[model samples]
Target: MTKAPVTPLLDRVHTPDDLRKLPKSELRQLADELRTEMIDAVGSTGGHLGSGLGVVELTVAIHYIFNTPDDRLIWDVGHQAYPHKILTGRRDRIRTLRQGGGLSGFTKRAESEYDPFGAAHSSTSISAGLGFAVANKLAGTPGKAIAVIGDGAMSAGMAYEAMNNAEQAGNRLIVILNDNDMSIAPPVGGLSSYLARLVSSGRFLGLRDLAKKFAKRLPAPLQVAARKTDEYARGMAMGGTLFEELGFYYVGPIDGHDLDQLIPVLENVRDAAEGPCLIHVITQKGKGYGPAEEAADKYHGVQKFDVITGEQKKSAGGPPSYTNVFAKSLLSEAEQDNTICAITAAMPTGTGLDKFAAAFPERHFDVGIAEQHAVTFAAGLAAQGMRPFCAIYSTFLQRAFDQVVHDVAIQNLPVRFAIDRAGLVGADGATHAGSFDVTYLATLPNMVVMAAADEAELVHMVHTAAKYDSGPIAFRYPRGNGTGVELPETPQQLEIGKGRMVRGDEKQGRKVAILSLGTRLAESLKAADQLEAKGLSTSVADMRFAKPLDSALIRKLMATHEVIITVEEGSIGGLGAHVLTLASDEGLIDAGLKIRTLRLPDLFQDQDTPDKQYDEAGLNAPQIVDTVLSALRHNSAGVEEARA
Candidate 1:
């Protein structure tokens, strides 16, 4: 284990209040110590490193200048909040980030009073900050609402919408545009290019230039006095015309890493009594770390690493990840079909569309961090007779639910939705868990939803979506590796709304039938093995399609088996609810057959290993076996009572 870095100035600080007690001279030292401490902590725990490193100086300056907890400071996306966490009384638990029962990787309202608004999603901070500012004005609160948003987050429409309404908050809202020229990937879109131009314009005025400009407008005696005023300092540095047009007092293009420049500028902005201010602070994503600074992605997210060498720990070799499989399959499909195009909402690498982007540059569209636009854009493409694959993570797809329903599903566009990270994503916690996609998408009319049992199945589903032109079709797959299934050399286009029985014949006296959806087939097969050992014949069926569910297979299972259990790695209204509704409509359950549903519990599960999360949610192999046994016992009791 690596020893924690020596943080002399940081050791003296326990909270933001402790930071405020220190003089301006020690702030630079404190920032350095804070950076070292943060790097060390993240090195052990393995989390968002580059973002926190970029915001070290800015974090110190904000907490020191602003009266936090009273002054609501919200970090956009909260990936950069590690430094904020350390300063706001969480330094003791900093090493426990993203662990089972430790500090969350992102800012959580329940975790700290300093975190006024919790966030994991991007571009939400400005709107949340505006709400806070407006509420504080109504309540006559003393503090301001500061939103530190990234340049990448600016690509989303929500930020601009909030900026447009910022005037309502009066002088209480402060938006700090943390421009590092990157989000998760190198930022795309016009906003990115515009920000780059703004940074490179070289129009930033120094303090002397500010004084000279102010001195010209004042009398000789007042001229000297005017130079010392906060207004003069603000006027010198404040020149982002684009933001000014949006009703914000634009104040920056300042050095974010330089505490000397940041502290005074922020102090001036805090005291200015302006309506709404936007401080554009320039920074490098991986500011101090050598390895991160040199790397293309700047080590955005990393595993546990050597502090000295900056070498990350290697994963144990296994089957290719589901993401890689999807990428390969999509590329293969794209090779044959000229009409097939790909789209991602600022998540090229995360959704495995980066490879597709490389292969078909002209055909791929990275629409920044705009999921809603991506959905509608894909709809437009599909309407124009082009096959558009809008590959998005299931969690993020929630943001564009309205678009899916109104634009695509209602119009019956042939848009292919490749939803990655379809189930519990460990460490990111409930906010990022893809638990409700099945419920949301499956509920929509003209929408076909499928979940892959393994990587091979995912390939077939991709082909199926490409071939199907009736309406919007979506296939969901899990976050991690496949179940070691051999990939088919030539992918087959699966028949829509059909399921395959992986184990046991329907006529082989099967007492219990396990209807598995998504990647829970592995656990279902395990449960079937356990049931067979216990002298109870069990059949396992991989019900791939959630929407337009395999009604024929479901009927066969209902007719043959005395006990039928529906299992999926989703929430209540997903596979189980669909099955129950179908059976009830068909009058299948009216017979003396026992039925049970296994799914993620109603409440949101916290950060843990995928296996542990499934166990907690009662969707594991043992839980499946228990559900089957318990249902069988209930049926046996009913039969005996009737005989008596």
Candidate 2:
């Protein structure tokens, strides 16, 4: 058991109001204490460490400068809000972060009044902030809307779209660009600090205002020339000419870590009565922690770690993750087919495309935080006679639904969607759960959807997608390590729209049939064992494809079995829904044979262990047995009631 580090200043802060009471000079010490507390808390809980570390000072400065709850301060992608959580009346529960019934990893509206808008997805904060700002203006409320977004988030088109429309809110909207790359600002030292102080102060802006008025009075041509010259000069000094063109008053390229620089600038921005402003603040991802700074990812997300050594606790060695299986399998396919390529939206490593990138540098594309562009880009590649795999997380892929429908499905393109994280992603909560991908993609006219039952099946699916050149095809796999099944030496392309019976023959007096999609096959097999032990003959089948479901297999199961049940790890409109629709359409259930569908419940499940979540959804082995027994009992009772 690890003990928390001493945090004297942080201990004093129960909320942002407590933070606001402290003098401006004491803010740097508070920020240090806050960073320590954040590091210690995340070290125990194992969550997004680097992002929170990056924004420690900024989080402190904002709360100190602005009256939050009243003034809407939204954190984009919310992974960076751990420190913000610690300061905003959640410090006691900070250690329980990402655990069951504990605090969420992202900002949630239900969690706190301070978090006006919940966010786990990137590039949404600007638009949400604009909504708040416009609503406040209409209501005549004395509040401002501030959106703190990252540089990576700005790559998405939605961020720019929000920026283009930002003038509507005028002074009510504020956009703070947290540039971790330090691309927008000067190096962190004397010159950057000096420049930041001068610009944030009233005197510098007063002179600039005077110059602007004088320039407006000049001849039209001279004024235009002067404006261009001024824009160019500012662009050379501070990199925000593009933001200015999008109708925003561009400020800074300031040192985000320096409290003296940060506090004054935030104070200035808070007091300013002008149009929308974009303050470009440079920050380091892992500013304070030595181990985090030294790491390649800057420990963007971490597991439990030793505070002294910063050595993360290693997981018990097991089978390779589904992500690794896909990457290796895709690489194998690419070796044989040179035209095979991979693309991910700012998640090369997350999607295992980093392995592909390393192997095939020219063929791998990392379209930074742009899922919509990634989908269409793959379509373009497929259009030009190349096998393109758009590897994106199922949750993030929702951002490209329009492109998936319009550019890929409607056009009948051969772009392969390698959807990872395709089930309840534990700890990320409802926002990041890959629940709807099956329903969304299976409903498409020209789309083919498949789910892997295990790592070996994932390899086969990868090969299938590579060889497939018909229309849009997708294959989904979950987040964690695969079940310890032996991998095939070579990849094999599975027959599309087919399923295989894993247990029991049709003539074996099969009274109960369990049809499983995705990784729930193991549970189904276990349920079959339990049913067989109870003198109930049962059959289990693994249905690989959800879109082009094995109707023949369904018909065979329905004919042979007295009771049939469909199981999947996805939400309601997924495999179970498809199976039910098939049974109805084929008139298979007209004989009144008992049938049941087990799926994730209608509500968004909160963050918990994957096993616990599945258990809660009643998709486990015991639940499956209970469903079958319950269905049989109901049928018997109904028949008895009719006879009476």
Best by lDDT: 2
CA deviation > 4 Å runs, candidate 1: 182-239, 296-298, 634-644
After superposition, the stretches of candidate 2 with alpha carbons farther than 4 Å from their true spots are 183-189, 214-219, 296-298, 507-509, 634-644
Residue 422 of model 2 has an lDDT of 88
Each prediction's TM-score against the native?
Answer: 0.91, 0.96
Global lDDT of each candidate: 0.87, 0.89
Weakest ten-residue segment in model 2 by summed lDDT: 635-644
**Cα lDDT tens digits for candidate 1, 146-212:** 9999948989999999999999999899999998873332323344334333422324334435656
True-vs-predicted CA distance for residue 139, candidate 1, Å = 1.5
